[model samples]
Target: MKNYKISAIATTKIPPERIFAVLDDFGSWPTWMPSFERVKVDLPTNPVPHLNYQFRLRGSVVYADMQVIEYTALSRATSFRINVPPLTGVNRCSIRPLSQGRYRIDRIDTIDLPKVVVGVLDATQRARFSRLAQEFLTALLRTAEMRG
Candidate 1:
């Protein structure tokens, strides 16, 4: 198996608290994240630590159990995948306050997977993941701003 780190960062004119609100509401992910078909959370509201979730990815047969390992209000969150073949990760997301009510959003996934699975990802798959992450951040900002 090989270890891979995938990350995406986005800067927006949205407040960190607003961005964090979206992150805390795990059930709202499917409304914006294009890669997510459905997200079933153990809790309907805040992302409680140690809570498990079932994710259904769009256009993909892969299903995984994601457990919330850490969550800090308006700051950071980390999750781990369990019982998934050829894929597992400590996925972390963070929001930082910037100048003029702007905030920086970051998502990182440190994954361990078989070499063959990594090889199959090629440039296209990698680019797609990056794009999705970017879009996810943008949509999150929009959703948060709209709520204010």
Candidate 2:
């Protein structure tokens, strides 16, 4: 299988804690993130600390379920993975405080798939996903700014 990685970084005026909190709240994703049509927790009534969530992507009718495997509240780092058919990727989101009132948001996604499919995706589909990531980060920063 071939591996695909896409990364993006953006600076925001918001603090790491606020950014991390917003990101950790999976249910609120659709509200702030325009790319998702819906995000629902299929588990128990109470919140699951390291839970898995199922989300339906907007525009396209694709559905993916990802597990929140890593979370570090102090460092403001969280990661999720989708290990199912059609999509197999890991997404890591982090925030680091910079000098002054600025903070940096970094996102990295690595996907694994067949080599032939990866080559095709690299030529055509990967760019779209990259753009989506950029837009998502931009919207996230804007949302955070507007809330303050």
Candidate 3:
């Protein structure tokens, strides 16, 4: 497996609680996340460790399962992919509180893809993926900052 990892960190004006609210709701991700089609959680309860979800991403035909491995309110969360061959992923997000209702958000996405598939992705695709990540982050920030 060829591993591809992307990490992003940004300081946002939104508070940690607001950002965590958006992160905890799996189904809401499609509204803000780039290329994210749908997500179905096994449990309706929010952000519990060991919670599992099925998700479709980037218009892919296959659905991936993810189980929450660790969760802490307004702080950190981590999840691992399940039952997906040649494309396992371990994704994590952490938020740190800053002064004046600001926060720092950090996200790490580690994907294990087949070597052939990675090889097929040209420079343009790589750049596009990077842009997608940035766009997703921007959307998350916007969602968290919006007034109720």
User: Could you tell me every candidate's TM-score relative to the true structure?
Assistant: 0.75, 0.77, 0.73
- What does candidate 1's lDDT look like per residue over 1-148, in tens digits? 8987778888887777677777766667677656565544444344343335433322244455556666665555555554535367777778777888777788887888788888898898888878877777777778888886
**Which ten contiguous residues of candidate 3 have the minimum total lDDT?**
50-59
Residue 21 CA error for candidate 2 (Å)?
1.9
lDDT for each residue of candidate 2 in 1-148, tens digit (9 for 90 to 100):
8778887889887876677666766667778886565544343355544534333323234445555655675333333334335657677878777888887888888887778876676545777888888988887777766765
Each prediction's number of clashing residue pairs: 0, 0, 0
Model 1 segments more than 4 A misplaced: 38-62, 82-86
Better of 1 and 3 by TM-score: 1
What TM-score would you give candidate 3 relative to the actual structure? 0.73
Of the two candidates 1 and 2, the one with more favorable TM-score, higher being better, is 2
Number of the top TM-score candidate: 2
Pairs of colliding residues, candidate 3: none
User: In lDDT terms, how accurate is model 1?
Assistant: 0.67
Clashing pairs in 1: none
